[model samples]
Target: MKSNRVSTRGILVTLCADESRVGMPGRAAPQGKLTGIGVKPIGEVQWQLLYRWLYGVVELLSGEHFMLEMSHLDSLCFEAFLQTFAQTYPHQLHLIQVDTCLST
Candidate 1:
């Protein structure tokens, strides 16, 4: 992954990733206010912990307006998890695709 800045509909997007290393994508929200950046690794064990935290966020935000960038993920299991999560939520969660690289 690389660092790139994009502006869309008055929203500023910052993408950060290391291609050589596999990690989650971080998003900076509009107006540069929200710390949209994803979790940062502290050690090997933290991945699972971070994932659980993300799951909680997904659950909490269920049905609410939100954006998800799945470009960094290529796991069927994770996709399935997201599908289930989406189904379990009550609000209408809108997924906004910001970049073309995630189409795959």
Candidate 2:
């Protein structure tokens, strides 16, 4: 039997997200020995590229269009990443679940 708790808006989407360290400083010269050179990073700003994907984001509802985005991580942490997503699509997100090994 189908439950009566189905969402009236639409089916929930499972978002896939990941972060990678990009624009990081190249390997430093070891023991004061020069090993060629490349573009150096500016200042102490750490950067990580955030990627997210969700199927059928636009086909679900009207006046609620949202798309994928790529930006540097604010604090280089998972929480910050989640916050950014939430802020971007505040009306779309309903629940958040982090992967954890737990017995019910």
Candidate 3:
């Protein structure tokens, strides 16, 4: 038995996402004194690799497409994106597909 509730908003947003990274700062150097310097990051991480991600969805009913870009991707970033998407499309359902491994 299911509840007799149907949403008037007829949109199923299916999103596919990919993340790519670039500009890793020329072999990367440590923020602190180097112990024989072999590209080891010690102490606080001062440099970050630039990352670009694209998450997009197309609404079949309305033919509307939206793509989102960000510098990096993490649990925090994912949450923020979800919040923004929800605020923007309060009535639409979202489906996100991740195609990359998030760096730890």
Candidate 4:
């Protein structure tokens, strides 16, 4: 009997970015001080399984916000993040089949 197996030729990729304020109650809250960028598989299961391998974080001062403005260093970090994503591509592709059709 022939072996049943599938090879992973390619995988789905996704990129994400967001910013939020972080500070203790006593300390002054900086606007958009924390930012993160990451790449991961499209599905929730895969993302949860391996999110650490593809992400970057940056701390910015009050003057910086991701889209409206970005420092030169921030741009470099973003470039590095893209490079990391390309370098750390997933090794395996997960396939899922769903059956939700109802017969009339």
Candidate 5:
């Protein structure tokens, strides 16, 4: 925008995005404790019975949201998501809002 002229587009979009890469329920973190009368958990292993992964975002301007279930958290998944999003949105811009910290 110039000093004397203001410019706007037809539709400018922003998004608040997030992802969850857990396979099964209660697998990302332990939901309960396994205590047995002062028993130690030295040799215990947390089972990651995984299944599905998800990436999601909500459009801040429209309150609309989209969720995609992908394989896992890797560059391949991210690239694929970018391709799909570009194909669907077509030159639209987005801002993901995960872990957003602003310092002065």
Candidate 6:
């Protein structure tokens, strides 16, 4: 049997569960949009912190889309990136399994 694997590049967006919004940034804003706050990756530690913050925001606001921007990454590192992201934001963001076609 051949192992079939799908290749995807770009952000992964997900919706969080309802009834968990409190003190979360962008809670009062529109759906599928990030809050006015900006995320800057100062270093690896700061990057992780930003990721956690983004995950929290996504988790509180259900029906809102959370995007994982992956354009900067190569296909070979996609899976590892996804795994790390998922682990960091476990049970916070719900993964929406769907394939997206991009024309470049």
lDDT of each model, Cα atoms only? 0.32, 0.39, 0.56, 0.31, 0.60, 0.33
Candidate number that wins on TM-score, 1 or 4: 4
Give the runs in model 3 whose Cα sits over 4 Å from its true position. 1-9, 22-52, 58-64, 100-102
- When superposed on Cα atoms, how far off is each prediction in RMSD? 18.8, 11.2, 9.3, 22.0, 9.7, 17.9
lDDT of 4: 0.31
**Clash pairs, model 2 backbone:** none
Model 6 residue 76 lDDT score? 38
Error of 5 at 76 (Å): 1.3
* Native-structure RMSD, model 6: 17.9
Compute the lDDT of residue 67 as modeled in candidate 5.
Answer: 72
Worst 10 residues of 3 by lDDT: 1-10
Worst ten-residue run, lDDT, model 6? 1-10
Candidate 4 on 1-104: residue-level lDDT in tens?
Answer: 00121112234322234422232234233333343566443433211121122223221222211122222234464456445534444343323222332312
TM-score of every model versus the real structure: 0.23, 0.33, 0.46, 0.25, 0.54, 0.25
lDDT of 5 by residue, 4-85 (tens): 1111333455667777765644553465666777887655566667566687777665557767889876668766876776
Full-model lDDT, candidate 6: 0.33
- lDDT, candidate 2, 27-84, per-residue tens: 4333342334785644453344344422112322233333334343333444455665
Q: What's each prediction's clash count?
A: 3, 0, 0, 0, 2, 3
lDDT score, residue 66, model 6?
32
Summarize candidate 6's per-residue lDDT along 25-95 as a digit string, tens digits. 33332333343458653433211112111112232323233344333333434455457556654544335
Top candidate (TM-score): 5
Candidate closest to the true structure, highest lDDT: 5
lDDT of 3 by residue, 1-104 (tens): 00112134445555555444544454344545666758764565556555576545454555455556766657676667667667767765777676667466
